[model samples]
Target: MTVFLCDGECEYSYDDLLRHLNQDNYFPLLKTHHLFSYFGNLVKALTNDVPLVLLDSDLSPAELDGVDESLVNQSIPLSVKRLPSMGEVIEALVHSTSEITMFTSGTTGQPKKVVHSIQTLTRSVRRGEKYNNQIWAYAYNPTHMAGLQVFFQAFENLNTLINVFNRTRSEIFNLIKKHSITHISATPTFYRLLLPYERAYSSVIRLTLGGEKSDGHLYNVIRQIFPSAQINNVYASTEAGSLFAAKGENFQIPASIHDMFQVVDDELLIHRSLLGQSDSFRFDGDYYHSGDLIEWINREEGVFKFKSRKNELINVGGYKVNPGEVENVLNAIKGIRQSLVFGKANSVLGNILCAEVQLEEGVRLSELEIRRILKDSLQDFKIPRRIRFVESFSLTRTGKLKRL
Candidate 1:
């Protein structure tokens, strides 16, 4: 296997990787080779009931102090290792049930711990010769659900994985070019940030966008960069592994799982069977409320589109406005690289729509021009009353927009 890092390349054969796994040492905390160590730990966990905790590699000392004590104690750090006499424990763990714990990105709020088993995590990933021999880029952190999916997909199919974690845009570009990466799965924010580099993407054969709404503007931008690649917008969550995939601008519910999902009072409800844990959300015997609002695109054809999170709805003078809708329109506008729309307090209006926009590098755009463009596409109430141009938006460790 070939692993590309910001500094240089590291190659390890299958046997070499196994030998490294068998060595008596703790895995590196934030190194690029953490990918290999993760698999190594996974192998050991499979044979024992030891749960794995993945901390954010970018966490500060203060942040690390805030982590749970049990998790911190159980966590596998860079210098620790299992004892050699634990063969019996490893055998028991391999045959016993164990869980993998991951923390949310906290893009919406405080990051929380989520638990999942190997079966639920890999249920939706496809494996076969069709996926083999392909080269994939490790854009997401291996700890996040999206990152785990990318790793498992490549591992199960015997494909090559090039580590690009913690790398700058220029470094990622060079790595992609060097390895001729064919598949990439990342959030829309990551893609938007990388667009300004304008690196050659002819080598990319497939693009998967998830963790955020995939609007038409992003689809168009990706198409321009990699014309021949297959672009797919995937709808998934840490709770729900992988639910649906859409090729076009809209996220259409697949017909095969039509009965597994439903829209009730504008909230999307997915069957409980698809979720890793169903206790946090409102779950009846069979379905779990997804907390996301959905709009019917074609009632007759069972087509629908994601509107926004039910909790994220902006109240504009008692008129509800979905920020995602406004952001979608803003993202489609020329020169706007990224945007965040939200509700701001107003004495007279109760609440008013506001937007913060980040333009492409070297591109100058004014608030009035953006407002004028919004006037043509969005309703007066839905348009942001206040628009501000910004240099860049804050992102969480998982590459999601950090909503304030």
Candidate 2:
């Protein structure tokens, strides 16, 4: 829409809406296209729906053709279209965080939308960009909270926002080599995937990992790949955002938290991060009865290491899904008796949801039917990519679904 030529010393394009954003005139960051997917969704949630049609340069019609194809409902058109340049994306996000919408992981239940003020969103960017420089390779997205932070941080810095969508590890490395990318933040799974091609380039300056564990599985390869680069681990969630983080190769555990945490049953309780708690989350006193099940890597150090998730939330291609969301839809089928949702370990995404469904005696149904129902109702991102039928499910002593 409004493009800032971004050639005169500032290597970024800003929208006319930015005239209202700031006086400092610089935010250095780069974000991938998935963030725009979130933006497309965000605008819809504000209006109480998702756009039937999506415009994105990163996705092909084949990728989105199966989205919503009902004829009568075709009237309920949702389009996914691709736009060129970062300036256009910014124009679409003209309103600040206060005007933005946030949806939870819905791990315990249905995802809830929290209307964050543009100020809240701004606070997140301000706090995130506070200690760190605004420059980046622009790898994050805006669909999730973390990605949004990356987008705004770069906008505030007036740094180059490089785009290389659908590129493989080698292609990305080549871009990094050509652009001299300095900072990059992605999931541990992303880093592990990058390891195979790490030899292609050695210019990485800083590496940040989250969205999954970063122990030896990830850190080991990182050490071997970028011996000179720094590595950091972060612990946070969609609702709680990021709370505790450790920078550099040798991360010393944190001491007593200065903010949000509880010791219920010897486990910590985390509240949703104050969107304004600066870029890095600061623990505040509000004790949100958190739902996380994790332990520490402590012999005595406060540094925490993630063991596993207690919730049914799965991350697929950076999209969060609640198994129950899909299970509920499947269970509604006339012949379906019950269902179970679990994430199978994935190499690219940290974990992806797979469903096991049971049908009534002498009755059979196709997974495609169940999937169509689920995909139609929930975000396509939330639909399970894999489906399996089970004769029956095993229950635990506590009366919970057991892994097959």
Candidate 3:
């Protein structure tokens, strides 16, 4: 009689999950905000070997190129043997031949489709007795890659998931204490929103940050907030599922798959054999350029630290400025919760660095003050010329800070 999900006032038990799996039909293009229904459809599709496409509830069919608006959320018959228990469903999912189609967050352009198998999606999942009974704070859009990674990891272990994505800082903290949440896996932007740490939540035993680069300052603060937790980073993408786990500040490719990776001119390239099927992916030789620029900590050991995305570096007056590096400095400033740095087209310089900053609640600072703080940390061209204070940040479908 274990509970599967606790979302707001609604609670779903293992029995409820079983009942959903026994349904006569499943939606191939399910779009819903209700996590339970979304998860139910996902499970039903995978368990019954039904292929399905995951769509963000807020995304319009027009935004995606191939999706037919009329066919969305439409149910189709799926006849499969009934599973008496949740364990049976899990077993079926583990051996499923179903293909899952997911789209990119469309931060840079229109959403592109990538189809993945259950193996690639759950490659990093570790299942054992130690993984059981761990309560998770689900903190990403349920349809995205990172979200699906967290879901499969927890679902396979039959662990309880407490929906906390998009929840306010106060509400999240309250839930951590109320549920004694043991694990949290989310993006750096999601963790940044919880800054200006007020108190510790000792119950969080483990934390995993992915989908964005993290810094030592954020890691130090997270350690203080969750002193008992073991924090780590993961590398995942729309083109590839979770691939590397952090070894300190760097990531070391597992020795078994070591030959599958190569660094060419600082860009990490992945062997095509390791990636999901996607038409948008263009390969150079048999490898796909990951766009992630990295510096080797140890070339022999295949250990490296992420520098920044190849496309995210902004050129300002012949100087290349890394927005992530600048934003890390902004985030380290006192009373600043989160910051987004980007380039605005300029008549003179080609592009001028600009920033949007969100301050801690009840705190105020002038843009000049922020500039003065940046003067000490950054080079002249690297500092943002324009800074706008804001109440909140716009997030992508995957809960990352929206960028141009």
- Clash count of each predicted structure: 6, 43, 0
- Residue-by-residue lDDT tens digits, candidate 2, 1-404: 32222222333234432332322221111122333323324433222222222222233234333233232112232332233444444444444222443344333443444444444444434433353433365544334555555555565444444553234567667667766666676654345345432363456667777654345434655666766678776554445455556763233334554444555554466645444232223344655544444555563565554444445457788876656556656655566656677788889788777888777667768878888778667887677778888765554211124543
Best by TM-score: 3
Q: List the residue pairs that clash in candidate 3.
A: none
Local accuracy of candidate 3 as per-residue lDDT tens digits, 40-123: 999998988879899999988678678888889899888966999788889999999999999998888899999999999999
Model 1, residue pairs in steric clash = 46-94, 47-93, 47-94, 48-93, 48-94, 49-93
lDDT of each: 0.71, 0.49, 0.91
Q: By the lDDT metric, which is better: model 1 or model 2?
A: 1
Q: Per-candidate TM vs. native?
A: 0.84, 0.50, 0.98
User: Taking the tens digit of each residue's C-alpha lDDT, what string does model 1 give over 1-404?
Assistant: 43322224555444544455455434223323355656656655544445566666565444443345444424353332343433342344335465776666666665666677777677667866687678888788677888878876776565677877657768878888888889988888888877753645799999998887768778878787776689988887788777777776567777787888878899989897777752345676688878888788886676777778888888888898888889889988877888999888898878888899998878888888888889999889998888988988877677778776
Question: Which stretches of candidate 3 lie above 4 Å from their native place?
Answer: none
